[model samples]
Target: MRSVPRSAEFRNGGISFWFRELGCPERRAALLDTVDYDVCIVGGGYTGLWTAYYLQRADPGLRIALLESEFCGFGASGRNGGWLSAEFAGSRERYAQLHSKGAAIALQRALMNSVDEVIDTAGDEGIDADIVKGGMRLVATNPAQRSRLHAEVGYRQEWGFWPEDLHLLEHTDASRLHVDGTIAAAHSPHAARVQPAKLAVGLANVVEGLGVHLFEGSAVTEIRPGDGNARPAAVTEHGVVRADHVIRATEGYPVHPRGQGQEWQPARSSMIVTEPLTDDMWRHIGWEGREVLGDAAHAFVYAQRTADGRIAIGGSDAPFRTGPARDDNGATEPQTIAELWRGLARLFPIAAEVPIVHAWSGAVGVARDRCPSVDLDRDTGLGWAGGYAGSGVTAANLAGRTLRDLVLGHGTELTRLPWVGHQARAWRREPWRRIGPQLVNGLYRTADRRESRRVTRTSRFAGLAARMAGREPHEPGPGGNAPGSPDRPGAIGEASGAAGPE
Candidate 1:
């Protein structure tokens, strides 16, 4: 069914195949003169774009300006695995412990709603990103994984989730979905597949259509919040953007103004997309519905069947750089891409020979407590949202709506969500931040290897690894499920580099 030739080789380097459909958005003119607006947003990824969209809808007269270092969606937004699942970054218990259970549940419901909101809005806006609402399936290949998955399902039911929201499936039932080696699996109907770059480009265009000033290639060098009496301003090398409010929506990228380095840790994720499969290959896989698929591993993998019949798989085993640095260009490490190919082959052996057509990597911001936050300080007229921990495609939309509510001082249900006004602890500097991700990655892979050999009980080493990695013990690594969902718990650049597409 693929129109593209199977002989097509890898498209190496930064640009993903998703971004090529639009033939690369011409970089808009940079801001060269001082400009004044009612609102100034830094980072033109989904967070900024969505925030602009909602804000303009709420009040069209609000003068808003958005600045991006590169083109919009050039960061994690353009390069993610395109999963719009209701996966909150932190544990539901964590959210409840920090705030109230009501608040936690409210946030969970909001996330579930955000997925539909995105699809509905995209339709109304005429932004076709090859969207498919097949939902998500998480397979457990080992007994240990099965145990954890069942526990997750039980926990979700206990939390008052309807039986239909999340439930387990037998191996036979799961195999029908093309996820091989499925001892057990969890299914959730609240997910969808998307073409990440197309959605990003579409949003950028839609927001521009709404009269929002989008400045590409304009990197913000400084963010100067105003005193109680004055307005805040974002300083670019060529211009200054003064506004009543200043927003920092940079996810996965380095912290700007040369400070707040400890505020967020940069984690990288890489992915590889295989050449489009033939009809015979499709019959072999048996995933005609094309539900977004993920597996249960200490170091997990996530995948989706591209509209073009290709398979794009992603994971976060790449080494972490020192000083919390990020790779702006979506380039992949050879080893990372190879590992991803191996993961894809393991899941679908019939396509083991499928050529990988593209590979890329991106970075995402990780908060200290592994939870995202949206906060606005009316005193300083500063608002920001990020730290999605990797499951941010849908979370970003929620964050944008939350940011809009906070900025406008409406304080509806969006603002009442547990993540609103949250200030996670800062990550440790250098040795701890740099060495932590590597240590965690090594431990997870080791745990996965050991668990694969065992027939009963989860590995104690895996639990330790999860704890060290700042994830809940027994959860299926980082890409498990929504924190409070029946499946288990769970990112940001709209699509943090940890999860793929980026």
Candidate 2:
């Protein structure tokens, strides 16, 4: 039974619901026989499905198969906020270290391209995911964040690239746009929104069309790596999948560590959808922006309106325990979801009247450096992708192509991304990984405390002071997972405006 009310009237009159059609049907556990292929994907989410689609497209003759523990899109792919974005993990300095600039650019470009690829793929494959293209908005809550937003645009210009759909907003204009506490706003067309479940089903459909075998309900219990000429294989409840390469595509709740402790750490994220609002309510808010928006909150909160005219809000910075499981839908604890609900309601007054129609939680992998990993264990033929941290939608598609190119010995631009070389294996066991999140959250909380004393937070000194008070400043640390330190989250002013892609 649900701890909270599962069904209730939302702020607006229209009701809201979640996408229930997830996973691929062909991969169901009712397998009649075993099969072998050139590539065996151990997941059915975006990474696996996209990889299979691209791999088959590149070479129709290559034998590829995808195996999912549940159905396709059973994880984050189906339940996410439907954010189709190319936002970098954190910073460019991090990017430069991941791979060559060309590689990084190519990597993101491929993901950006997948936005269209996904839309077209959905239509062509007869999967209706309610894919919509409105653009994405990032709202700044303060001047400091406003400055950060400007710096980002400048940095992108220096990089000699900016998405055609980038825009910056001032406070006066931002305040009138609809939402409150908005000081600055940024816009970009490179991002998009989609119906989560349909995307997975559509992509899976496309892969199946290409003769790729898909197995659903085939939860992989173990993975056997390749040795010498032997290929890698995934052992599932239904049967065994053998292939030249085994790709682990589960993003949020990724599989157990393979070779290292930094392989993956599961972090729970929660979200709620409201009953569709009336047109008059929308007009009262005058939110014609029709874009996804995230604000500068101590705990990151992003909300977007769906194609069906309902609001989907998500919060990720809630305190959580690692490796904990929720409903199959992957929601966080009840209190956490309630807190996020309150946050959402605070941002939009109409949310009070709009009852929360549906709520769910899911998990994602956090690497040591807080980046995703695309590694191919040549010794075992067990290639995998994980640690997307928070932003994995667009990255997942590119990861799939990269994995395929690496497996096929094809040196394409897509494969040259820094993602392949950036591995965060064995992070949870790492001291920093284990203790870093807690300390960072605590520092953020402290900053929040200090900022609360004043009207606004200003200066790098303040951010520094917060960090200093929270953690002992040490030399730059390596990227990997370890337990995080317990500290309150100080408000690290956010960049309210969206800038050019990193």
Candidate 3:
């Protein structure tokens, strides 16, 4: 095991470092009585908040109420790795299977555009989340990783990504960033680094200012689809919120409702942030552009340079917690923290001595097919958008707009995207759910270790894991699992639970 700095503080399960820096916002009053509205959106994270923002903008007169179990952004929204990239959460080929390859390509392009949309919205709304459009860099530190990096570039090109969207970097260009042992790298301009909590809190205030009712500390026990005469409703402890349209926007943290329990499996990802670095340390690091960073490893690591000069890095070193249990408080294991620290040290030796100030973890929603979806039942007046793996930061925005279009009965370009109404199969029940992720994670970890030991090719363990997961080795999903499996690339986690109402 790698050595960890003993002086570092451990603040596990305290929400997250982002929330701590921003100071948790004062909670909005919980719902005290039943209410009626044109729309009731459960979960006040990015998806629900953005949905309310767009809906109110489209029609100011529409009554909208957003319910949250905790304060807005309390879940993955505030706990993510702060990457607003154009990466989608599902398989491109899988999305193409639902529509045409052209349609899937369009969806990818739309996500690329959504990265800008989020930046522009933050500016328009005066939400200063330290937004910086420095782009993203995926570095290859080993020969095996280099092979996968080039393969990913080719994969993107085959799927219609223009050169400007993503391209290879020369060794000199890759060295400019100064990540240790980087032999090759890929760059994409369609990404930004953000102070995630600031954006979530600011957006919450913006929607409330727009006359959207936001009720924090309001946990919805269940969501019921409307029948012939009844309207869709979000049943909460205080009261039932009935609306013409009810949207379930909970990602990862589902309040399970009936048969939908296994629809999304919540995966827990852990993170650690260092104390602000010194000026001398900064010079040695050479990440002046402050672009978000990732690696091509199967058990990948993701990182970002905070505006305050701290380095926040994360990975899926922790095993998935089985059953419906979740680490809602952002608790991280000591072993997980040590593993993440080693990753940081390996990438930037300068960070080895820097004391870690905080560590936390959060869950991300993953569909069995490893794709995200946005859908509404016009007949039932019910809708939902989640299963982002770990790419919810940008995908949530697109989902919000798509949900708005679906709610308003609009047939715009956003609605025609392949993920708009796509539905992935449910996760397997119980023992399988518990066994599958553990097995896959173990395989990927072994593959990474083998690659580190100078294996010049992608390990067979990774291929085997991909096949076990019912995917090909060339098909990358959300979080980094293997070549063809569905998993989050950077901000990934592991856990199991029933899909419940938002």
Number of the predicted model whose lDDT against the real structure is largest: 3
Q: Which ranges in model 3 have alpha carbons more than 4 Å from their true place?
A: 6-9, 257-261, 320-325, 477-502
Model 2 segments more than 4 A misplaced: 1-17, 20-27, 31-34, 98-106, 155-165, 170-177, 256-262, 324-329, 430-439, 442-453, 458-502
Q: What lDDT does model 2 reach?
A: 0.59
What's the lDDT for residue 377 in model 3? 89
lDDT of 3 by residue, 266-332 (tens): 7777788888889998888888888888888777778889999999888664454434536558778
Ranking by TM-score: 3, 1, 2
lDDT of each: 0.74, 0.59, 0.79
In what order do the candidates fall by lDDT, top score first?
Answer: 3, 1, 2
Candidate 2's TM-score reads 0.82
Off by over 4 Å in 1: 1-8, 170-172, 257-261, 320-323, 470-502
Instruction: Give the winner by TM-score: 2 or 3.
Output: 3
lDDT of 3 at 293: 84
Query: Which of 1 and 2 is the better model by lDDT?
Result: 1
